[model samples]
Every structure is written in C-alpha cells, then in structure tokens.
Target: MERQRFDSHQEHPPAWISGYHLVYIQEGEGIMRVDGDPLLLKSGKVVLLKPDCCIEMEVRSGKPLFLYDFSFTYTMISDKPRQAEKVALSTGHHMLSAKAAVQLSLLLEQLEQRQGIEEPLAQWKQSILFQECMHLVLSDPVSSEETGGTREAIEKVLLYLQEHYRGDISLKEVAHMHGISASNFSGVFKKHVGLNPLDYVTQLRIAQAQRKLKASQPIELVAREVGFKDPLYFSRIFKRTVGVTPSIYRKHRHTDKIITLLPHLNDYLLALEVKPFATLPYGGNDHINGYLPYLARELQETKLTGSWNKPDMDELVEAQPGLILGSNWFPINLETVKKIAPTIPIILRDDWQSLLLDFARFFGKGDEWKLWMRRYEQKVMQAKSLLSLSHSSRESVMILTVTCSEYRVYGGRRQLGKVLYEDLQLTPPAGITTKAHYVCVNLEQIQAMNPDHIFLTTNNSNPSKEQIKNLKETKAWSSLRAVQKNQVYEVESWLNGHAPIKHSLSIDVAIDHLAANRQKPWEAIGM
Candidate 1:
C-alpha cells in the first residue's frame, strides 16, 4: 500500500501488473483505463485493476486525485492465480461499502504499525485482520441474494444426478426434471457448476470408478457399477479423467485425507476412528459443539474452515482434501469446491442415522456402521432403562432451550428431540409430542405444560443468571411441578451433537445428569 496524489491533467501510460490493484478514490475524479475500457474513476468508487488489465489514467475535472493504492496477490480458492474480477471489482465499477473500507483502513493501519515489530502475537493479529478485510472486500450482499436461485437450481440437478447417475441418463431427461430446456439448463449448469451436463456425469462416473478401482474390483464390473454399459468406453473415459487405466490405478491405491465440512459429518468421521485432515466447527467452545468432547482433544488440532455452507475457497485449497464431505444445509458452491478436490454433498435429512450410513458406505465402512448401530442401540437401551427406573411411566419430559427468555421447545426431528422422545422412550409433555419445528412459549405457555421433569439448556442464546432468577420469581415459574420438585435439570446442549455417535454420548450424559440431579430415585448419584 502506498499513497499518491496526481496533479490535474496528468496522463500516465498503460501498465500491467502481476497482482490485483485496488485504488481507494480518496479525493477528486479521473478516467482510469482498465482492460482497454475507460472507466470513470470517481470519489467513493474503488478502481480495481486485474493483473493483466492495463490502467491508463487521466485526471478529469476535480482537485488532484489523491488515492491509496493496494496491490496484493490473492492465492485464494481460484483455479489459477488470476486477478480477482468476480468479487466486487469487474465490469465498470462498484460501490465499496463504507464499513468495509473503514475495516480495511484499520487493518492496514495495524499492519503498518507492526512493520518493524517482531512480536508473533502482533503479527498474527495483523494477519487475521488483513484476511478479514479481504473477506469483507469480497463480500457484496447483492450478489449472494441474486445467485441464491442459481445455486438451488444447480444443487437440484446435482442431487438428481446423485440419485440416478448409476443409470443411463441424458441432458434432456435431467433438464426435464427441473422443467428447463436442455440448452438453458446446459448453460446455467455450466455457468454455476463449471461443467456441462455430460461432462459432470462423466466426471461423477469417473470419481465413482476411481473408488471401485481402488478396491481392486474388476474393470468391467466397476464400469457397470458406475453406470457404464460399455466397458471399453468406460475405460477410455477413465484413462482420460484419471490419466491411468483401472488396473494400474488400483495397484497404486493409497488413502487420502478427507475434509468434512459440516460438524456432524466431522463427528461421524471421528466415530469410525478415522481423523479428518480438517473440519468445520461443531461448537464455538469445544465443550458445546459435539457429542464426544473427550475426542475433541484429538480434533482441536484440526482447522476450522471459514464458513459453514460457503467455506473460504482459499482454505479449501490449502487443506488439499482427498475427499470433501459436506451437507446440503449451506449454499456451498459445488463448482468452486470441486476445483480443489472432488466434493460430495450429503443431504441432512430427518434420518441422521441414514446419513451416517450413507457416509459409511462412501468410506466402505458399511460393516462398521452396522456395528456402531448395534452399539448405539445398546447404549440407548441402557439409558432408557436408567431413565425408566427414575420417573414413573406416566411422567413426561420436556426438552427446551431458553432463547432470549422465550422457551423454544425442541420439536420436529432434530437430534436432541429424537434422543429424548424416540431413543429414550421418554414421552414428551402434551404440546411437544407433535411435528412442529419448535413452539415458542412465553412464561405462561411454559407454565401451562407443567410436566413432571424439565430438561433445559441455555445453548448460547439464553439470558444471564440474574434474568433467570427474575423468571423464577414469577408465579408462572413457582407453580411449575418440576420447578417446585427441584427437577428442572440444567444440562449442556451439545450443539454439535447431532451425529449418531455424538447423540449417543449426549444421551448418556443427559440421563446421568438427570439421574443424579433428581431427588426421587437417583439422588444417590447426584450427591
């Protein structure tokens, strides 16, 4: 970064650079030529120059143009070291957010302050701030909303291919499913997914083939398994895509590090005793994120990728994942993530166990999944037995969290609800048994249910203890049977404990805590 002020009518010849050049139009206005196009440079507008794009300048009518020029190379998630054009910097020009500009200025100031300093902590702070500034610069709120539909259409196509890719398919047939013409779907799919329909399917086939070949399966059988009727054609595509024949690739098979993006996927990976190279955060604090907090000691070393749905491309590239496991919960850009490695999206449905099994099968761990399911069943049964021994069969349990003082009863098929309502055979109180996502209950609504036991977790959203004390003083609270009986057990809500393994551990912890806290049957354990 350097500051320069040019006099009026000053003309500079075109120049090419090796990195992006962003000029913060501090004052005045001019015409900056970019890519042979004359872009009107003005105050409050950032002038972005791509690496190869030439910039010819002529100060137009105004005071001398004073600007801060920032030149930096972006090694972020691009397929190649190209100039950043897609992010708020292409076409004519775009408005920079005042907040973002201020943030960048602060970061730059910090960086300048630490130029000669040797403190590692100071340097790390500057680095993080600089990265954050870059992220903010890349962030333009308008594009995310506009591209949302585009992302969905592409995802729908991808899912269709996933479900039916093993059979003979064509572009028209798939496009018909989405009610779009072949030509339009082809263009949209390529634009968003970076591959035409035929190419995508062929790549999908090749990816599946690679796995089967690695298992030393027969070339012909593998071809049939991945949807190729003609083994000869399959072999040709395989060699082209993988750069090797099936038999040769199989002989050189080696395990590659898998990157699991969703928190549950990370826990699911850990359940098989296989550590991921990196994963997304299950929880902000290690304690609240996943089921096996104990195993977090091993996982704490893993990198927490940038965002959930749309992770930072640069981070994905750096991880160098052999396989990427993600969920459909986020707006994950399939085309971009695939550039780093083969990316697979797992749809998180009500059937989390089924999701786990799917992952297991992908990793060739079907047998392990079955074994885990058996042990999981055993664990559930044990927890159920212990819980049944505590409260009467007629007694009910309520699972809820206090979010900003309102009680959000966990309904629907979420993991915590499943563990309490289904796995433990614990009947929910009258209102919570149905299929609603969550019933927002005020103090009166909370008091109305008045169950035998209440299992409450604050999660990270609840009010402070002082606020709870105020709630307890209300007539609505004192009238509750659980509160009067001292059965309002405050438990940890494992935010990341949505996976089978994590849910199992969470179930045990809940039961143990419930058994220990209640005065009736398990007071023996509590004290």
Candidate 2:
C-alpha cells in the first residue's frame, strides 16, 4: 500500500503496473487514465486496474492531491463443488459512500503503518486489513465510464431473464450471450437488480408457482412448470419464503383470518375489503383513541390486540389468525410471531400503489385491486379538474408536519406530497427539489421557501400541538406569504402514511382545503 501525495500539480508519465491495483482518491481533484480510458477523480473516487495496465495521471493545476495506491494478487473460490478458480477484478472507477470512504481511509492508514513489518502475526493482520479494504471496494456498485456498456448489457439481460424465467435457463449461457463473463455478470446483475441473478430467477419461479397453486394446479405440475424439477425441494423453498407450506397457503389464500401488527397497515387490508381479525391499538393521550380516525369506523369490529410495545400474546393465540402482518416500523420477534401464525413482515417503501398491488395479488384479489384503482383514478381526475377550475393547480404547495421536537418538510415522494405533486400535478415550492421522503427544516428555511400555500399536520401528543401553537406566534411564521393570505390549512396526521386508503383520503383532504375559501386564521388553522 502506497500513500502518494502531489504537493503541486504535475502530469505523471505513463507507467505499467503489475498485479491488481486499487487507487482511492483521498482529497483534491484530478484525472487518471487506465489504458487511455479517462477517469475523472475527486474525493471518494476509486480506480481499479487489472494486472499490467498502463497508468497515466494529471492533477488539477495548482491543487494538491492525495491518494492511496494498493496492489495485491488473489484468487476467489468457486461455488461449484470440486471447482477452484481465479476471477479477475473488473477494472474501472467506482464511487464510495461517505461512511465507506472514512472506513477505507482508516484501513489504509493501518496497513501503511505496518507496511514494513515482516513477523508472521503482523503479516497476518496486514493481510486481514487488506482483505477488508478489497471487500469494501469490490462490494460497492461500479460507477465508471467503462461500466456504462456493462450497465446497458445487464439491463437487456434483466429483461430477457424476466421474459424467460420459467424455462430451463442457464445464467452462464445468458451472460455469454451478453458478452460478459458469468461471474462478472452476476455482480453487475445484482448491482442493477437488488438480488443475485439466481435468486431473482427463484423469486420469479415462486411467484408464478403461487399463482398456479391458487388455481388448484397439482404440486408436482406447478413445480415443473415454474422451472423447479424436484417437488419436495420446491416445497421447502416455498415454505421458507412465504412462511407457510404450499398446501396451507392454497387452503387459506381466501379464508385466512389476519391480525395486523402495524397501525397503518390496517388501512391496506380494509382497502381490499378484508377486515382484519384483530389489530394493535394506536392512539395515545393526544389523538383519537382505539385506531386511526380515518380507519376506525371500518375497524370497529376488529379486536384490539394490545399496544404496540406490549402486544397481548394470549389474544393473538385466541384469535387463531392464519396470518399476521407486520412492518419495518414496529418489530416483533420472528420466532414468537411464527409460534402463533405465519407472519409476513413487510418492508415499507412509501409507495402505496405498489403496496396495494402486491397485497391484492397476495390475497388473490387482482380484479378487486384493478377496480379500486379505477375508482381512485376517477377521483383523482375529478379532484384535478376541480383544482384546475380554481387555478390552484398552478400554485406551489408545501406540506409540513410538526412533532414535539422538530418540523419536517415532505418531498414529492412521500405522504401527502405524492398526491399533491405527482397525482394532482401541483407544483412544489421553489428550492424544494429533494426526492427524499422528507427533510427537517427550521422556520427560517420555511420562510425562505415562502410557498403559496401550507398544509400542516402534527403529532398526536399535546406537546406537539403546543409546538405548532408556539410556531404560529413566531415572527418568522407571521411574515410568511401563505400566513398573510390565509392559505394555511390544518390536516389530519393520519393522512401522512402511504396506505392506499389513506392516500385516497388525503386527496379528498387536499381538494377540500385547496378549493375552499380560506378559513379565518382563528377558525381552524393549527391543532
């Protein structure tokens, strides 16, 4: 490992290096070429080189540059039984996350400190640290000019895989057709898609199997049709992924009594007209009791299992639910939940459309889902037409949520923002271009954006309400154009989750507020 520093700008003469090389830029800007492929460099950029690659570099004139150049030779073991093989690293530039950059910096520093050590123990430690550095670089998604072709190839390959997943497909053959090696194709495929190529194939097969099983297809026939040769092996994989055997899933696909562990997910089940057998309690001293106010009417018949922190295990067992729905927000012990019933802990992605479709397909309610979407789309069209009549569609809007601690500004991708910015085609305030779920902002930042209208919601707690009350009294709040125009409106906190029912309800809330005469400041502005 070598830490190379250029105190002053200089063009380096081209040189050839042996073994695999990793060049990490620590600071400053420059351009480096590996075999005439220009790689722009800055902080956190890495340049990987295959053995005997010609290297050339130029630092930005008058700027100091610091980088680490590490070289090593290694071979990877093959997954195939009785096969050991060597795989070369794909040479290119890659970008690292800030956290990973910091980690790599420290590892390189340690390796450099002990570079001269010859003792076996010290050498072993150095080897371990070098391996760690290699893992960090190789594991990162490749980002380079050289990788552009690889990315395009992988995308076409992905489409091909999806189109022919049910056939007897060999990933190696597919990679060869795309002009990429089998091993390299796996890494690139995973970078584009979130799963390994083989795992993706399995997922596609199982999803098809599920649809077939629900249609009363024989187990062996279903397995063979979906690319699985062994029925017993298929059953094991199915049980592991779906949390129930194929027979059990098919039997209870339509008749399962479900218990919802997450508060917001109740809206999803109810939207599909599947009333949950039971649900966890929702409110505290500051909001409506029992469940979310918007969903409470429909969920009245559903049993309240317990509070989120302390669920009633006895009631869960007594409900005899065939399944339990949980989410990333509220975690429960997998073993504990499985002991009662098959549990599906969904990872919430703040995408209501996809969530609704997935649940609809899972429950064999595809037609119901399509019908629901048609109605929702009709509602959206009506709302958009109404807003256009009032010219509110042309105005920029902002959605802000206040908790006891801080104020959050939602972006176009989350909560009410999705309805306003995407569905209704309303403009967002200037300088608010983030696609993230939200960003915390101060009153001064909010004043700077100076949106045409503001929609505010608060946490259920009284202290949160008090914070909103206090915010209204501040000079920063009083000076806003929306406040002066009386365009500020109070909305429900329940409108903030990405549930299908809640998303539809939020559109109603938005249109009602956007088209109405601005209510008096004292009438109903905040909590």
Query: TM per model?
Result: 0.50, 0.56
lDDT of 2 by residue, 1-527 (tens): 88898655455789899998888987665667778866566667787788987888877524467789888887777767557677866776656765576567667767877899999999999999999998898776556733677755765576677669878888889999988888787887786566989898987787788888978889999999998899999999887666567887787676548888887888777778788888888865523458778777788788888785557898888888888887778657757887988787877886787888777767756545655674566566556766876657778789899999999888888778888888888888876754767889998899999988999989667888999999999999999988999899998777777878888878777777786443221111010
Winning candidate number (TM-score): 2
Q: What lDDT does candidate 1 reach at residue 454?
A: 78
Per-residue lDDT of model 1, residues 428-521, tens digit only: 8878864555677787777778888877776553353446667778888889998888878776655424677667766655666565333222
Q: Pick the lDDT winner.
A: 2
Clashes of each: 1, 0
TM-score of 1: 0.50
lDDT computed for candidate 1: 0.65
Q: Candidate 2, which ten residues in sequence have the lowest lDDT sum?
A: 518-527
After aligning candidate 1 to the native by TM-score, how far in Å is the CA of 374 from where it should be? 0.5
